[model samples]
Target: MNSRLQHLLEQWSNDQFTEADKQELIEMLRSASAEREIIPVLQDMWEKTEDEGLFSEEHQQTIIKNILDRYPAGELPDKKEIVPTMYAIHRTHFIRRWRWAVASSVALIIGIGAYYWYQHMQGKRPVDMVQSTTRVQPGQNGALLTLSNGSQVLLDTLQNGRIVLQGGVVARIRNGILLYEGTGSEVQYNTISTPKGRQFQLQLSDGTNVWLNAESSIRYPVTFAGNERLVRIIGEVFLEVAQNPSIPFRVDVNGSTWLEVLGTSFNVNAYENEGAIRTTLQEGSLRVVGDRFNGHLQKVLSPGQQALTTKGNADIRVFDDVNAASVTAWKDGVFDFNNVPLEEAMRQLARWYDIEVVYQQPVPKVQLGGTIKRSLPFADVLYFLGKVGLHYKLEGNRRLIVLP
Candidate 1:
């Protein structure tokens, strides 16, 4: 508002100030009563960046052009994305009017022109064309190792390359994953844990690839030593077990369900909170020990079929067009919920988003049917739910409120 300040800003536009003047102005921003009150004047100075001075001037126009180049108008806007917001704000503040303002008084801020441009160009908006977001969370080295001496180390730490040798085995952490190589005859036990809002994949000593879902842990031997290879899993895991018929591989969970497999690909969904233990075979046969009474309770399974065990004898059933992709989408980075109830869908969301579940209304009447990106900021999931016709709101960045 002061003529003196306006004069100084005008001089700045003419490239009269030294670098010290720029530093002084920047420092004033932190101390001034109305620090941003001077911004309009400073913005005028940026016009100098466009037309270079004989000595020096503003290169702002060139710089903005470069930054905007990194982001082009793409398909769908990720609901929880910041890029669009940044672009929107940037367009709002610049590129508004080419109306030549001969007087320096009206050119207080450089963005006034662009702000008007945004106001007029509102209706002809670009629509969603690309994927809103990638429906998968990045993989994390979420392994927790319980040592032979009853000690536990979170393997995800030691982020850099480090070798931890124990029980005649060499376990290394490259980046975040725990890599192992065995040398000795002794079998040592270790456990890998994935907390809420996280997941992990590991290769057991017997060459079984285990994909553990959120809020889960799997305990297994460091090396397969003798006749049998055994492991205990809590929560859920997709197993691609190695084949060795001579020595039976067993997975023990709960009290009744015991899985015996010989070289096969299968999945076990046995979360502690869930009432049933489901063992779905993808390739080989697994005998389910439903009742501790007899070994005969073991049921065989073929591809495209599933076995459900509930304290008693396990039942095997076939499915129509088994949801292979949706069922195993977590391994590939997705939550493919096709016609699943909100209560059931929230279970997966609760684990991945690391949030507590509390419904605000009669469980939503709608069924969730879509694939959502796991890595997106949790709100993206809720936003997509709304976009898909569900009525819900976010609370405290950690809760979802469903409105009836």
Candidate 2:
């Protein structure tokens, strides 16, 4: 056994190596002679991710041959081939990592960081490693529409057309978007809710376009009335307020904080589970106010700014140079994490996939930074998280046991 290879492989598995050490490992793989020995050792280490009988000798040989085919025999390949081979190695180990089960508290696969190359096939035979029976799918365009009289409609299955007629306002679903037209003679409240694994869009009677995030709800009047236009929200939403200077648009969150706007395009994340309510402005302006017994504290947010507040908190902090794209990426079907904590990132995974998170040990203080498509399976997201040294296992059916 090569002590250098073993030591480096161990360090590499734990992501404890430097760039120089990684380069050394790459050089070792370049040699067909060295690869012959390294492949078996790596395979032996990776087999820990799978249970008995799941990984076979034939599969190991096939994977080895597949990796070897990328490099020329008895000759060091060029940079292009070398880089791809490294990725292929990483991909293969990642694929293997997902088949893990925690039979004991101590992780059996201590030699993680192995990549498994997998081709995700949707609607086909579900992957067993993903626990297909209980695997949660990503959030989709869906919501529950509650009419003024309390009649409920599942917007996802509801066909496009005039869906509701209440208080003289005509509610229609056009191309998957719920829209309300005409003025209501009387004030009536309608609420649209996006469940844990769903989202939807709406156009209010005033022409404001609103995008709701998963696990969010927005309550507004069927038509504008009185001195001002008001709406209530919980969770996250992106709004493009229609210009109506005569009647300012106000967003009330949990009755403790609110945003007043004449006309603006902004995103508000008021998820009850999150630490703070974040209001990010993409265009125009708005006043974020936190209601307090000693009068309300307010902050004016310009384009490209974000205000952070909490329910009943008098102080509202503003972050100027925020990643607005990251703030609203969920609306665009992506998970963008920029220096986000492991707990926060997992919370996002939990909501979008409708899974519960369980920590066997104290949660690690690790920050992840990247963008991943929210459409991937829960296991696929776990694989991406694994790349950043965060290990997790899917428990029973709906719980994810995160490992340190």
Candidate 3:
């Protein structure tokens, strides 16, 4: 299909198509037989969209009306009995604005030569891929909570409403967010942790909001009664600190890195397996400090900056130009692997899907860039790696062996 026409179709499929655009699309669909054949594939893709909720029931009915108007009968897919082949789309100008089509950086489709594919006797294969009968589903809102007395509670299984009361604070789980009500003079500590393939959000007594990524944990007090509001975290977290000039907000990350702020929004990724702690600041100013041999190494970061502290090295480095969107993309449920090494990218996948990654040979020197919806099937994620000449296979149920 021509590029402009494809843009129009994408807009129409996203429910953002204008009346004028819809008229144009209908005329094109009626004029071209090849274009008309794509309607079935479009419908299938839309049905699998991660954001299908965006299309209300009424909007879906409208889309059906438009398709039936063109076909006159509900024989669109019947005419083309073949299932559409999937492909990986690069960051082309034509598809830059169509990220909504798929959940990830790359989208799957019927026609695209940019992706690698193999022809099979049965049908067309996008890649030499295999599917496990038991697919590992994506993670959801789940975590384990540990109270001051060491009592444990599974947050996911607990029903909403008041779940805990201690240290003059009442805790509740409302719509999947753990919330604390009422401030307290007496401080009681609590910890929340997300196991592999799970994530959760929390609202502190001070009104600060925190989102914990998979395989992550955070420890905080039930209320902010100290001179400074402090929390300790391991793994990854996106925090929006409530503004309190009287009490500066402090984050103790992995016991080595520290973040001090009056009130700001920032993300800290201190996954020990990642070999470094990265702090990306999005709003307001904050100081990132690393424990050094001499004393301390610190860098004050403004908005749009990132600080990195390598493992076994106390030296801190500041990056003025940071990809804030990509850094905190995890909180938004999208993996933005823009210029990320293959190893690093796989580490993220391993954590989210709770799969083991083993390189059968030397790792390929490949850097990938794209946005992928985290909700995509694990098989689809592997299909994307095939585009860069990297191949993988599932061993048993949870092991992924990457081959060059």
Candidate 4:
């Protein structure tokens, strides 16, 4: 065993390891031979400590299966080679001393090792050998605000203060939140649009809270003046409509779909590339209407129900028992991939990273299942995807070419 690896292991066993030491230990264990040696040590440590019931046997098996199933048939490493790595990756994290943090670090090591091992089996250059000159950071809180007078303000760069719009309507930005104050009778409209790699939060004049996802926009009146409060949105938005039984709130999505909210919380995904508009109701009831090219369709959704409207189709499909948390995970700073298709996952990445994805070959038929933090760097995100047998190459700073 390497002296440094031994010292790190001692620190970890004694619960004295710093984060950097833990990371270094993970990197060192990337060697297959080292993995074999570390497995026994991890098992011994686990055996000495009483099981804390952190992860059940069924859950552990499921996680192991999820990782192993990423490889194609007959291409997987030998069972002897894989079992030890899996044990090391899965069991070490369960040590009562460093449960969650150690799990993340160990899982990353396994992902990196699997990616390199697959590349070796295919006679391709390892990931480290690839030339990547650019580092893309995660998206930030920012958007472009279009005033009623056709003037635009870059919210990311603007100072936090009160801004008087047309007719003396005041908008304030404090701690990165846009809040509208006072009331107006003229019903002037303002639009907040988030470009790729950006998101923003806004409190409408009616006290409704709106969260704009990447490449999304919401246009609404400066204040609620009439009996009906109406807004138009593009891309995706999660809204918590303020309760007002007298006035109904309506959302016009890209001029194709309409959502009526009677004080409900829901999310709308209407990206053109997605081929369908998905509205997942989180709380309260929502009425969704789809205006297709041929006909019109509508559906009333209950809480936890999702309505899907295909573009150019006249039918509105409602799915029951939908995962509302997974649907609005982005708003909560997570990328939920539970049963998400590969193309859809890539689209999320493209939007958040502000990069274009091009397929050099046929798109891989894969379903990803996991949750990753949206705060991770672009490179780390790609590394996590490698656990699913996905390969890619970054060209220049903005293009991600998917490999077969």
Candidate 5:
């Protein structure tokens, strides 16, 4: 037996293994030669817990099978050739110190049974098995559409058909997308707002597409009439403007910032709770102008660039080589937390899950990485967080209290 492996086994048996120890154990498990020694240690540990009824015989076998399935006989690839697969069972980055969570969720295979066993011994229930009836579903496609006449329509429940608006303008709903048809000289404004736990998609009369994230609202004219197409947005929005050099597109974010679109696709995050309004350009060019008390501060953003401006501040900061894909991941139904801080990640969960996050203590200085599907159940998402040492409690049905 290797001395280092022996030390790791001892740490595991004593419930004193640090994150580095667990990572080293995972690496050893990847190799075939080490498996010969590691498997017996796990079996021995399981046998010791058998009398205590920690896990059923069937459950123990399933855990062993899951671990073995990762490295089949004579099929384990070389260590240097292992490439991380996206959204794999083993590929999930959990809490701040759990760096291996960034590799995959399957990395928990070695610790899961032990985790349950320890919880049993400690007379505590697992997070998933907690006696709570509260269930918070994930966000879905939905929005509140306010017409020019102050009449509101719920887009999620409305059937697919043509919606007649003022000035003879027609807005059609097809497969959860709001599409506009026909032109009207009478300019009437319409607003689409998505509440918490909902998102929406829209297409302007000029063929420009718009995606509204949760807790967002966009107000635009029913038809494009002026030399420049303009819209006002609050919260986050992604726009794919139709190319029309003759009539440029413009966006007014929170009545404080403006985005001059030069026929391109970009995303604007102007949530009031956020520290700064971020404008990330996916492709083409955009000029971000800030309304300062003295004058206007502006910056031109190229592809993969992000411009951040604070409310009531004149200076605009540009971040070059930004991850535009990660910035726009929400538009594609993903929560990309690539180097995002803990509170910010919680804010996203608050919006998507329609839950308020109450911290029981001072916020932990933790940075999170990796991506999670927006469609996962709230509890499942919490389970991943628990694996990384995040202790949380669901209060009632909509409040998530983070414990220190």
Candidate 6:
């Protein structure tokens, strides 16, 4: 494929292909159809993308060439979307402009690749790398905090920097989590909330720790007082309860589900898009509760065990797994691709690096697995994947198009 032609095709797939350029594509398709085959591999690519993968950039070129060699001889139709692109990603912050940006990024990146595949595979184009936007953006990253006295605070902004004492208290942000330390007779309560696509953590005065996941929140006091410690939440969280046999700890979520513990460690996952609320116990023992069902308690679990609660449906299921590494991979800074779907893997990529994903054809059902440096540039990551057999082409400098 001619390098310029290939770049243009990728840009087309990205929706970055302008109207005038599209007219050119129509002309090329019409002429090529009479002398060469233009069988698109988007359908094939979508079916098993998760199970199988492309080996390298060279292999991708080969696939492109093979497809181009298969187009039937005829004058092609002028400019109707012959190839299908999966624009199915939804529920993303529900904002119009962001969605458009996301859509544009995906369309241009993927469209260019699809169009290039059509022309080049037939010996009409060349393969020279082009640059476009591959850095897709994930949703919001903010937190809503509520104090014990029914007061609220937003933590997303850099307000005075140090959240030390309001009246002689000391607060710290360590390991990306907030913590408070101070000696005072009055114990003030506080809450922390995270918006969709965001996460935050905190450490309480009594040494009980908590981590708030995306679209979730937690309510606690500045200091642990009275006979026991109590807190409430509506989303996902992880807790490391301070060992206090005399004073039990409790967590209230979903207006019904509850957990009690003395000294233990566990995690919770209750994102809105996801249907279940899961608590994976890493150490110690805890009790589960629910409001939907009268007898809605789960079995006690040992280390490496978990409890799950479904939305609207009130039934807790206990599952056992000893691989703590898999559960805690995100926290430890590793992109764990353990048999993940093409869409899901791309979604994670979009979130961490702030980029968008667009499929020129349908998404393949191949399962991808591996770990890589999350900080690597999008091109380097794609290049590595191409070396591993995934076919793709870049346009401009931002879009990532999925090739068949």
Deviation (Å) of 29 in candidate 5? 25
Q: Model 3: which ten-residue window has the lowest total lDDT? A: 70-79
Question: How well does model 1 score by local distance difference test?
Answer: 0.60
Report lDDT per candidate.
Answer: 0.60, 0.71, 0.71, 0.76, 0.73, 0.58
Backbone clash pairs in model 3 (N, Cα, C under 3 Å; residues 3+ apart or in different chains), count: 7
Q: What is the clash tally of candidate 1?
A: 9
Rank order (by TM-score, best first): 4, 3, 5, 2, 1, 6
Identify the candidate with maximal lDDT.
4
Give per-candidate clash totals: 9, 14, 7, 0, 10, 61
Best of the two (3, 6) by lDDT: 3
Query: Model 2 over residues 265-348: C-alpha lDDT tens digits?
Result: 999988888979999999888998887344558889988899988875668999998778888888887787877777888888
User: Candidate 1 on 219-285: residue-level lDDT in tens?
Assistant: 8888877788888988878988888899889888766688888888887878866777877777777
Evaluated at residue 340, the lDDT of candidate 6 is 59
Which is the better candidate, 3 or 5, if ranked by lDDT? Answer: 5
My TM-score estimates for the predictions, one after another, are 0.63, 0.69, 0.71, 0.72, 0.70, 0.55
Model 5 global lDDT (CA atoms, 0 to 1): 0.73
- Lowest lDDT sum, 10 consecutive residues, model 1, at 66-75
Kindly indicate the candidate among 1 and 5 with the higher TM-score. 5
Per-residue alpha-carbon lDDT of candidate 4 for residues 103-174, written as tens digits (9 for 90 to 100): 333333344565566446446544443344236778989999999989988999765878898777899997
Q: Rank the candidates by lDDT, best first.
A: 4, 5, 3, 2, 1, 6
User: Quick one: best TM-score, which candidate?
Assistant: 4
Per-candidate RMSD, Å: 14.7, 15.1, 10.9, 6.7, 13.6, 16.4
For model 6 the TM-score comes to 0.55
lDDT of 3 by residue, 90-133 (tens): 21122223344432111212121112122221154322334351
Q: Which residue pairs show backbone clashes in model 1?
A: 48-58, 49-58, 49-59, 75-130, 76-130, 96-113, 96-114, 135-373, 243-263
Q: For candidate 5, lDDT tens digit of each residue in 126-180?
A: 4544444136788999999999889999887865878888777899999889999
